[model samples]
Target: MSFLDGKSLEPRDEAYRTHEITKKGLPLSAIWKGDANSISQLTVFRHFDSASVSEGFIGEGPNTVWVIDYPTLERIYYDLVVNFDVFGSVSHQILTRMYMDYLRMESEALFLSFLPVADREPILKHWYRGALAQAKVFYGHSHLLIDTPAAIHYGGKDPKNELIRMIGTRSMRSTHSARPTTNYVPSDLKVLDNLSAKKSLWLRYLPELSYVVVHDDHGEITNVISMVVNRAHANVSFIFGEEDRRIPEEDTLMLVNGLLGSYPNFIFWIDQSEIGKFADAAKQVSDTKSMDQWVARYGVRRTDPRIWSVLDRLHYYKQHYYKQKDGESEGLLDVSRYENL
Candidate 1:
């Protein structure tokens, strides 16, 4: 029989028969007290550690009824036995719940990659349905729950100042409604090269521009913009490989400084293993403040809130699915932790 068909039968019939509970010596008197002739059949069952009898009664003599609510009983027993929380001790319940939530968010983010970008909004809206309600529980004001975009325009004569002002203004804005009017042109590469060349400490760890973010028609990397100002941690993270594949510390620091010049409050994160490389590079360069002021390192602990937030953001941007080469870890928290749970 199908599992659904088995489930449809009364629990007592199939469960009792399968277990041969009559051998356990459960008295039929516990099931019903009725007319002797009315007694049709008797069955006994063991559920968890408790035993009970199910008796078929047709007519009443000295009618007394006994009922065992197995489902509710089992739930109560399991909760008491498995979920008992001790006083003055930390409970894994909260951490486990948060980890599960992170996994759910990651899964939702991955699913978005399968959809066309144009169709993503409606799906995202549906998925974030109760977010406002949940936010309301924590924040007293309704205005705080709503997202409002800010606008800033940069119009100046100096090219360097204009570029800095434009990025800083955009970084300050709460939402990005339009793509940047300025593209990362070939001339912009000269600008970055010139800026790095002037700085004695700039390690030229430039990866291909494509590796940073996929550009749209306007040549703007929207995902990078979104992730740099992500609400959860307001941190940007980079994962590097060992030896040859490792991103240059100079390039990472330079990028961090450029972003920090615009958003002073932003944090930058790197893999825990790469911290020594950055430190060693920092010793050679005079710009040690960038590393000290904004940088943090993280390991593989899935329970770390910052790591969880970073993974969620990266997954949302479709940046977490890249294949790793030999001797390189993806720096992603193991999703199997939640899967196993």
Candidate 2:
């Protein structure tokens, strides 16, 4: 049977909304409009003993639906990727390729169906023409499409402009006209130093990534990291420096204040320095339950067990990862040592 078959996929029909409570005391029925719960129901179909749930609010006021599933949401995601061509836009195709590099049969099969026809055309041509640069451009385009946020989400935040600056140097090597071709000056060292404020578009979105680089004793950036809190919107905390293994107090204060002041959404990067500080501050709030306080501090949207598990995993990496001799040996960094930690 189809995934939605057993539980009729029809919209829940009830004026006051019929209620069926899960063991946890949460409602299992749909209420009001746009409830993602009604849209996607969770079910187990295999030997995999674990799964996660997801839910989203559609209309206004006190009604909503609960959507549940595995953490990866693999089934639904595969459907979306296979169906959406826009995912492989010239801007992000390259990044998408790299993101999928590690996937095996099931994952690769899902991604192969996502590339646009036009995107397919160039690669096909390159196969015949044997032009290596053309192939690189195809990959580059995919990279930008997946790595960068959409234009509508910009809200004058200049996502493209910032990327043009941050990656302009390396981008220059792709092709004369590959990226940052026109009026896009590479962001200089000075720009990187004073990036305290970030622009967010509307209340719904924030930057998906905020990157910082800390240089080593040799004056080379030895540490580079991205702070991400939102996927659809892009609110990121980016800082770079070598001497201190701590996010600057000003940056921390700024981020907290910005989150508390802005819309309900708050996003931040949780790197070693920040995680270390978090552990320290978490100690101060020890009187309170650690797990509960940790969730509150991170402002995680879901309290679901699987999501909590991922958060716990993050905590595990934070605490135990450093003790190890090589962070890279643990399925971590493969890029520059700056990115290794």
Worst 10 residues of 1 by lDDT: 226-235
What TM-score does each of the candidates earn?
A: 0.18, 0.20
Model 2 lDDT per residue over 1-341, tens place: 32213122122212112333322121212111222113221211111112212122111111111122232245445544863467468536544443333222122211222233233334334222333343334334333222222212222343323322323333333323311222211222222221222332121122222233222343332333333222210111112222233222212101100001111222223343344554344334333355346545543333333334433343344334334522332333211211101
Candidate 2 achieves a global lDDT of 0.27
In model 1, the number of clashes is: 0
RMSD of 1: 29.0
Q: What is the TM-score of candidate 1?
A: 0.18
lDDT of 1 by residue, 88-148 (tens): 2444544333333332333333223223344334544443443534322322221111221
85 Cα displacement, candidate 2 (Å): 5.6
